[model samples]
Target chain A: MIKRLTYGLVALLLLAAGPLSHAQETHTLRLAQTWGPNTPILAETVQHMADMAETMSDGRLQIRIDPANKHKAPFGIFDLVRNGQYDMGHTASYYYKGSIPNAMFFTTVPFGMIAPEQYAWFYHGEGMELMRKVYEPFGLLSFPGGNTGNQMGGWFRKEINAVEDLDGLKMRIPGFAGEVMAELGVAVTNIPPGELYTSLERGTIDAVEWVGPALDFNMGFHQIANYYYSGWQEPGAEVQFLISQKSWEKLPPDLQEILRVAMRTAAYDMYIQSTHSSGEAWSRMKDDYPDVTHRTFPAEVIEALRAATDKRLKEVAEGDPLAQEIISSQRNYLKQVRQWTNISDKAYLDSVAGE
Target chain B: MIKRLTYGLVALLLLAAGPLSHAQETHTLRLAQTWGPNTPILAETVQHMADMAETMSDGRLQIRIDPANKHKAPFGIFDLVRNGQYDMGHTASYYYKGSIPNAMFFTTVPFGMIAPEQYAWFYHGEGMELMRKVYEPFGLLSFPGGNTGNQMGGWFRKEINAVEDLDGLKMRIPGFAGEVMAELGVAVTNIPPGELYTSLERGTIDAVEWVGPALDFNMGFHQIANYYYSGWQEPGAEVQFLISQKSWEKLPPDLQEILRVAMRTAAYDMYIQSTHSSGEAWSRMKDDYPDVTHRTFPAEVIEALRAATDKRLKEVAEGDPLAQEIISSQRNYLKQVRQWTNISDKAYLDSVAGE
Candidate 1:
């Protein structure tokens, strides 16, 4: 009878241990990313976020990531997360502008604040509140997923010396920058990523504007196009993380904080990684093909581009109160912040540029 | 007999639950910070790190922070953590230059890579490895704690047009930069932080070097000295988080990652915060003090300062192989990275400056 009692007591202790071990229940989140499997920087960011979340939660919280190939919709991340097909997503916010016009601003705008400045706006200024207001209605949360640093203005076969040079310039510049270029009389075309190299090589396109040297080197745009112009459009292009409100609400407080901090760190780390990779790639490009020269649009050409950008931005902000609010807030913030930038980093850079 | 058996079973179950529930143990680390209590961004970063650690660990891992006032060893954070008096510390590595000369390079160097570039070096390049080598002998682990963006060159009472202007210039500039200045015939003196403004105002010092606008604005330097020169010294100054090896080994793998990611996010967040606050403060300074102007030292002055800095660095690297490795790595990395910077953000900023 004593032996029988001991066996029963041991079984009871095991049962009690299960409940006591985890005061909070475990949860698993499904994350859909815009990039394909093993895409550098962007895909790495998603994985980094997942690793941090899992490790911090001690496997109590798990992230099941579905890349673009699995989801079969690279640009459908926002919709997927919002509809609960996935608990979260990693994509650029601007890709969803068809459904939400204001989403584009969060990704980047022509002549927008650079990475650090944009981050400041999002965190310390009206950016977060405004971003929340945009995403809240859709029952989705948007976060800065990662940054690609300052993108290079596409690779050009010919140098643009004057505003007139833009006329009849066949380029594969997409989104709002394409609209601005169109306003300046450039023939802006959108080509599939796979066909870009062939098109540029075959004289099907005069210029191809992809990402910076890091991502661009893989596309082989430099071999055909020698003049690499610096970027004005999407100066600080930031990708985003989108989470379903349902998924967020289901998380325990600790898991919620873990996910939040994980995404934040991943985003910042990507920016640093981009900076490192771009530096290495650009250096390699210069060494491998010294003919690939860096150029900036002349003052006249820049003036025209800026004018077109301003006109387009104003047109977009016309009847949309929320859009106007965000635009004005960003503009005002940029005005104040750029002055500081000019006196600080820019001035310092200028002073040391000669060396 | 049944009642006594039931009581004994309950006691046994409770005893089993206690050990089984915590397969991973709880640990609380004591952190000593160089900043005093409530030291704005610096103090907030420490608290932010601790909060993230506690929340992510679900109270399993905790950090108890002690500010400088409580510890009375602001400059001795290295020694404190090394001796295991504090499990961790948040302090500038350069502050302990007298004891460990290599520690200063991890912080910032004169005309070094800016925040993003420096972060890239730390994470992607040889920075972490070199830093580990420096601290491993001391039996401590160091991580990047926070960044102060690009520090500004101090406020000067008059314009500096030529190299001769620095001769006999009584300035309150400390650290390696002070050594560099002294090489250029500047009478460099270290003043207590509290006395800097009065010293500048009363002509005890010709110039006062503080942090950038965010921290410097509060010191009332803008009211007295009008010329705020751009910084070449201590660009991208990063504070460090030091963990005692003893304390580090006590935590589980999950907690270690939690602590690491927390510190990284805090460091990046601090940089963004500094950018935001500096913009706000500089704007306020302009509005409140119309006479406060921004200036850059002329090419001759910059050249002289650069030469002096080079000479000093060479001297520092002369005998120490480790120091030479670090210095060479930084110089090479800066060369490659700065080229990318010139083409991207710098070019963009220059083009868009007029607008």
Candidate 2:
């Protein structure tokens, strides 16, 4: 009789302990972000993700984020996560092109699809599968962190009416776009971002390509340049969220789903936030500086730029089968998706644009 | 000594039951959706939301969705949820305009913002606040469920060349756009969705306004109608998720967050899916039926439609203060955001449109 009572007591105890143990089982993740502490939009997105994860998990999941200043490796997020020093990372994929050349395709390509179209590619097309193929080898997982929408080509002091206008033009346009410009006979140079405003104002650089109006507003580029041209390069620049496979596997299934959904929602939210802020900033820029007119490159100049971009892409794809596969996938997907964009949003925008 | 032993036993029993009680706590909510069972992207979005909610909460919070076929109320989702017969609903807000006049603004206006732009307004600008004011009285909380990107205006047998082309034209267009068409001297009528194909094929209706290619492809419209006009009526038609205030209050904070984020992510996913499906469907349509051509209404006809839409909007906002506030907010937000759209995506699309 005593043995039976003891067995019953043990059964009750196990049942009682199950809920408390699960409820109290908290997992904390350390995240490293490329942006400095309290950076707008970018860092905000990371915090937003962490907040949702924590709240949705009811304190079961906690993410402790270390920004660039804290981590002291702004562009080294991929390495940090890969080496397991950080559980997660928020950084643009293109910044690590030197380490992994194929990483650039995940960020954005010159003459690529816009934000929604690119997102469709990522979620519904071969983007996620292709991304998984690239990152899986390194024991890392990469997801789209956020987008800056379509970037402006640059703020220029003079108009480019023809292809020749690009020749010998001293412009601070970095990355693949700069290479394209270099191929078009332009003097492409890179300058420290902190000095870009002064460089453009003092004519050290005749033109500068920064981000869209939201980030650019703080740079005060509109105050210096009168012509704000539309972009060809980085049509939808998507940053990435990198996570170590070991760290991801530590969490239970429920927490894993929570983290994934939180990151996805925060990424989409950041895109919308970028859209709102850009609109507000552009409106303020136009109001403050009426002379800052929106312009597009002439068809002749655009065609030359396109040719340069295609040539550069071909060279990048040479000899690397993975690079070639990614390039072809994006090219074909863009071709199919852009047709819908042209007939829908583009057609609607064109019909209602004059107002 | 006996009393002390009894007290110890009671305390131990309570401790044993604590975890089991909490672990067994589960809440189930019944949701009624406007779409029929297995309604492709629309129904898929609701199921996605439910699956996320269930997985993230470890089945603590469960949503049981009832499609229109089960509930027998395609347009009465709001009423069903409001009356507490259903704990949640997935339907367009505008479908209840007869009962709540201000609800239409939540879906889409005649020539308002597109998907991303509208999402920006809803999340960042005055949209959520205005929506709260409109919905608060109903004891309901509504969120954006999903979006059908920029909708196609309709399929037409003949190309619309001028304003005169619309005169006395019998078109099956519904809701606010139908009212606007009537103002343009078009004999606007409503037809059952099932009979739409035959009506158009038999020339009973000269034109028909359906959804974009994804949904339209199934209706067999493209095979019969060669002219697919870009949309003006519903730039971004967003469906809504409705919850009873009581149902929301019953959820724990964590489960509530799970539901909210799941709905949000699912909504954005649906938008992306629509984009992907539309691209696929439109491409197939073009390849299979080479005679089909994408067309935008002539500028004169577009101008006439715009005028009629504006006049109707003015009438709707004339006496109602809340309606006026919502209308003005949308207009101002659209004006501000569309400039960015024009200069960004529109300019980029135009620059890279042709092969």
lDDT of 1 by residue, B103-180 (tens): 999999999999999999999999999999999999999999999999999999999999999999999999999999
Q: List the residue pairs that clash in candidate 2.
A: none
List the DockQ of the predictions in order.
0.65, 0.73
lDDT of 1 at A102: 93
User: Can you give the lDDT of residue B240 in candidate 2?
Assistant: 91
RMSD to true structure for each model, in Å: 2.3, 1.5
**What TM-score goes with each of the models?**
0.97, 0.98
Cα lDDT of candidate 2 equals 0.92
Weakest 10 consecutive residues of candidate 2 chain B by summed lDDT: B1-10
- Residue B141 shift from truth in candidate 1, angstroms: 0.5
Q: After superposition, how far is residue A191 of candidate 1 from its true place, in Å?
A: 1.2
Off by over 4 Å in 2: A1-11, B1-10
